[model samples]
Target: MTTTLFSAFWTYTLITALTPGPNNILALSTVTSHGLRQSSRVLAGMSLGFLIIMLLCAGIAFSLATLDPALIHILSWAGAAYILWLALRIATSPPTDAAVQSRPVSFWASFGLQFVNVKIMLYGITALSTFVLPHTRELVWVVGISVLLAAIGSLGNLCWALAGHLFQRLFRRYGRELNIILALLLVYCAVRIFY
Candidate 1:
């Protein structure tokens, strides 16, 4: 890739990863509610699932030559619906005590979420198809870039998780307000899918 494209690619990647999305939002909420130690499983699940998605995007970068617009529309709708449901859950869920018995989002549930996470789907697809694939078609390069992208995305989630962990006490004091704000942010993310 040219220097210009390389710069652009990294910029896009950072922006997408750092911005609030389902994964980041969930991570923050999970940590705020359950604490960092308890939230590890959820973060691990998201990272693993995100890595898998990035790998799939490498394959999809080639096959997307014949992708149907209708399928894209269908996916968008489904993703939006799922995000809305999550928003509702976030808004309604009361904060839990870390020492008490509470069910946080499990590894399996978070892993499955990646399959329908449209923001992540679009992020990986665009990064590979536009930036990585156009620059090189070598298998090693593609896989490497995918892994790097996954790492960057995981870092983004961790940033949010850390923020939540750092402010756990303040968040707990105003848990209801925080939940409402997070839910609204998630709703914004869902609505952005249409455009």
Candidate 2:
């Protein structure tokens, strides 16, 4: 990739990593209600999941030589369905103070969720196809980018968790609204995957 393209790719990557997707919303909600300790596990699980996706993208990119346009659409739809399911869970979540019955999101669950998460997977695929494959197709480049993506993802989730921790104090009086808004945004993110 040219210097201009490289700069653009990194910018796109940073924006996507920091955006309010399901992962961020979940991290934000978890820390807001459960605390950073709980959210940190979730963040770790999410990072592992992203690494898995990045490797998967690397394999797909290297093997297929080109991604099928139809496959992208199919994956997007499947991911959207899964995200909608998560949105339902978020929508029904009780307020932080009254959520005694709800279980915290487990690490395994978060890790598994990444496999079907269209946002992160699509992000990986986009990076692979747009930046890595076109530029060098070198194994080293692919691996390096994947590692960078994992680090970026980790930092982004951490930031979201920290924001949630801080917001816990600020939104103490409006907890329900926060949950509702997060749930709605999750739904929006799911819908956006298809379009």
Candidate 3:
């Protein structure tokens, strides 16, 4: 049973990590503006923040069994708004020659941003509630799952960042098109949250 549960947990974690979300989007953007080597620090900060958030979510799920759906909806809406704001910032920002010089996102900023990242919170709660066995064993499993998921999610972030790096030329060549795509993605996420 433990092995089966762990397998399911791993699958869930992978799917959650690979999916498009605010963190992934930000990571991609950072990579495009900077580079993968520089954006790695941002990924580190994000992973650390995600680990902390996942641990909190695991504890809440184990103790509460369920979370308030209304709160989740509110969080989702807030996340969507934030994404839209980011998209707008990207669209309107003037191109800088200095941006090619690798600049890392500040750790505190990355940590704080992850706090309101709805997708990570939802993923944590889902993993804790679904895969963890009920009891003391559940707590142990939750910790293990959270750590493993954090690692996997970090790798997924790296992949997204690398994708941005590989396509940096394309981004530079077709800046307007990329902005439109990003704006559409933000709008889609916003609509999805309400629907």
Which has the higher lDDT value, candidate number 1 or candidate number 2? 1
Model 1 agreement with the true structure over 1-195: per-residue lDDT tens digits: 899999999999999999999999999999999889989999999999999999998888865654578877898888898888889989988865632257788998788878888899889889888897777888899999999999999999999999999998999888889999999999999999997
lDDT of each residue in 78-184, candidate 3, tens digit only: 87777778668656543344456645566676677677777788788777676663534556777887787677877778778888889988876676667567667
User: How many collisions per candidate?
Assistant: 0, 0, 0
Evaluated against the true structure, the overall lDDT of model 3 is 0.74
lDDT over C-alpha atoms for residue 29 of model 1: 93
lDDT of 2 by residue, 20-85 (tens): 888888888778877886666787888898888888888887778767888778877877787777
* Candidate 2 lDDT score at position 124: 80
TM-score per candidate: 0.95, 0.91, 0.85
Clashes of 1: 0
Lowest lDDT 10-residue stretch of candidate 3: 93-102
The list of candidate 3 runs beyond 4 A from truth reads 2-7, 94-98, 101-105, 134-136
Number of the predicted model whose lDDT against the real structure is largest: 1
- What is the Cα-based lDDT of residue 118 in candidate 2? 80
